[model samples]
Target: MNTFRQHSKTRSRAVLVAGGAGFLGSTLCERLIADGERVICLDNMQTGTTGNLAALAREPRFSLVEQDVCDPVPRSLEVDAVFNLACAASPPRYQADPVHTMMTCVMGTHHLLDHCAAHGARFVQASTSEVYGDPREHPQREDYWGHVNPIGPRACYDEGKRAAETLCFDYRRGKGGGGAVDVRVARIFNTYGPRMRPDDGRIVSNLICQALADQPLTIYGTGEQTRSFCYVDDMIEGLVRLMRVDPAPDGPVNLGNPGEFTILELAEMVLDLVETTSRVAHEPLPTDDPQRRRPDVSRAETHLGWRPTTPLSAGLPPTIDWFAGLVQHRRADRRAPVAEASALHGVA
Candidate 1:
C-alpha cells in the first residue's frame, strides 16, 4: 500500500482511474478510497457525467481531471496504478458515435498504456463479455476466440476492446519486466447499480423505470435471452483485487456473476421488487443482442479467489431506489415552473 502523504483518512498510494466518473469507474474510485489509496480520476465526460462522482470530489484522497484520454494523458501526476475504463460500455452510447467509441477503446487505451509504461504502474483493461460476441460456446473461458461479426453495429466496441486487450498482453509479454509493471484484462459482464445512467437503455433500468410508472414492461423476444447481473460494488472489488495480484497475470479473466436470468424473469423480479402494478409486453430484441450470457468463474476463483457477493433480490432494491431518485428528481424539475422558464429560455 502506498503511504498517503496528505489528504484521506488513511494513507493511500497514488493511483489513476481513466473514465473514473462513469458507473464502473466511479464505483472503482469509491472502493480504492475505502482501501486507503489516493485516487486520480480521469475522464473526458463524453458519456460520463461529473454528477456520478460529485460526492468523491470532496474527499481528500480524490482528484479529478476532465480530459480526453485519446490525447496523451499529462505525464506530471505520478501514480502507482491505472484502471483503463474510458470506452462507452452501454450499447446505446457505444453505438451513438461508433468512430469516437472505437477510438476510446483503441487509441484511448493506447495512450493510457503509454502512461502506464512511463510510470511503471499496474494497468488494468476493463474488458467486457461482449468480446465473446454471440458466443458459440457456453460459459466462455479466457481462451475462447469469439464469434464476432466484424461489420456488425457492435463491432466498433467489441473489436475495439479486443484490440485493447491485445495491447495489454503485448506490453506485458514483450517487456517481461519485474512484477512491478502489471497488467490485468477483466472481462466484465452486465453489471448494474445506482449511479448508472437512467437513459442507458439497459434492460434493468428500462424495466424498473417502466414498472414504477405503471407502464407495460417491454419484454424483448419473449424474454428468453439470458444474462447475469453483477452488482457494481462486487465488480469493483474483484477488479481491485485483480489489479494488485502478482506476476502480471496477463489474464483474459472473467469477472461476473455465474448466475443467469432470462429477460422476462428479470422484469418480473424487478416488478416484484418495486411492488409495481404493471403489465408485461413483448418486443423485438435489437440486432446482435446475445441470447445467452453466463461467465465461467473457475478462472476468477482460481486466480483472484473472488466472486460476486450480492444477489439480485438483495441488489435490485437499492439499485431501483437509485434510479427512482434520479427519476423523481428529474420529474420534480419538470413540474416546477422555474424549470419550464429555464427550458423555454434554452437554459440547460
Candidate 2:
C-alpha cells in the first residue's frame, strides 16, 4: 500500500504529483525532493517526455508511476498533498485529441480529488489562464467568468480546465464522495523554461528553438497579441507557496508574472538573445486565439505572499542555453549512428 510519514505540520511528507514527468511537473518534483519530501510522480507520457525526469530517476525519495489520470486512482496511498497537473496544456497537442483532453481534465481531476478526499489531504488544482478565454477584461482576475467558446478548437482544454475547477470546488463543498479535502486552485499563466519540449507549440519554446535553428520565427496574425510569461522556477515557487499557505482561499488565484509583452516584442527579444539572422514569418491566426492575456496576481501576492521575480530578459538566457544544448546533442546523436555505420564499412 502507498503510504507517507506523518510528523509535524510543516514537516516534509509524501506528495502525489500528477503529470510529474512533464516540464512543469518535473521541476516541481525536483523542488520537492530537494526539500526532503517524498514524491509519487505519476504521468502517462502523452506530452510529457521521460527525458525531463532523467535526473530524478535515481532519487531515493521519488517514485514514478506510468499511469494516466483518466485511469483508476491508485488506492491505500496515504498522501499528504495531491497536485492535479495531468492534462495537456498545449494548443496543438491538446486539440489533436480533444475528447481525450477533456476526459483527462474532468475524469483525471475527479480521481485525484477523490484520493485527496479519502486521505484528508490538501488538493492543489493546476487550472489555467486559458479558462479566461479571449479575455473581455484587461488583466484577468479570478472573479472573471471568462468568455470561452464551448465549440471552438481550444474549447477542449479551456472547458476541460473550467470543469476541473468546478470539480475541485464541488469536492470541497462535499458534493462528491469521501471527506472534505482542503482545495486550492491556481490559474496558471504562460510559463516557459528548460525541459519544455522544443516543439510544444508555445511561443517561448517555438521562438527559442527556431532561433537556435536559424529558421524564420513564425508569427500568427499581426503579432500584436500580448501575453504574460513566467519562468518555470517562479511558477513552481508560487505553486509551492499556495500549497503551504494556511487559511487558503477556496476560490482560484492567478499565478503569473504581471510583466506583459507583445508577440512581436518577444520574437525580437529571442532574436536579439540568440543573435540569429532569422526573420519573422506571418501566418493565419488559429481559431479563438487570445489577443491579450495577462494575469492580475494581487490575490497570489496578498494571500500566499508570492510574486514572480524573474524578468523575461533575465530568464531567456538560461532557456536559450538549454535549448542550444539540446540542439547540439540531437545533432551529435544523429551523427553517431551514421559514424558507427561508416566504421563498420571501414570509412573514416
Top TM-score hit: 2
Clashes of each: 1, 0
* lDDT tens digits by residue: candidate 2, 86-142: 988889899999999999999999999888877778889999999999999989999
| TM per prediction | 0.89, 0.92
- lDDT for 25 (candidate 1): 92
Let me know the TM-score candidate 2 reaches against the reference structure. Answer: 0.92
lDDT of each: 0.80, 0.86
- After best superposition, candidate 1 residue 329: deviation in angstroms? 2.3
For candidate 1, the 10 contiguous residues with the lowest summed lDDT are 339-348
Candidate 1 local lDDT, residue 237: 84
In terms of TM-score, how similar is model 1 to the real structure? 0.89
For each of the candidates, the C-alpha root-mean-square deviation to the true structure, in angstroms, is: 5.6, 6.6
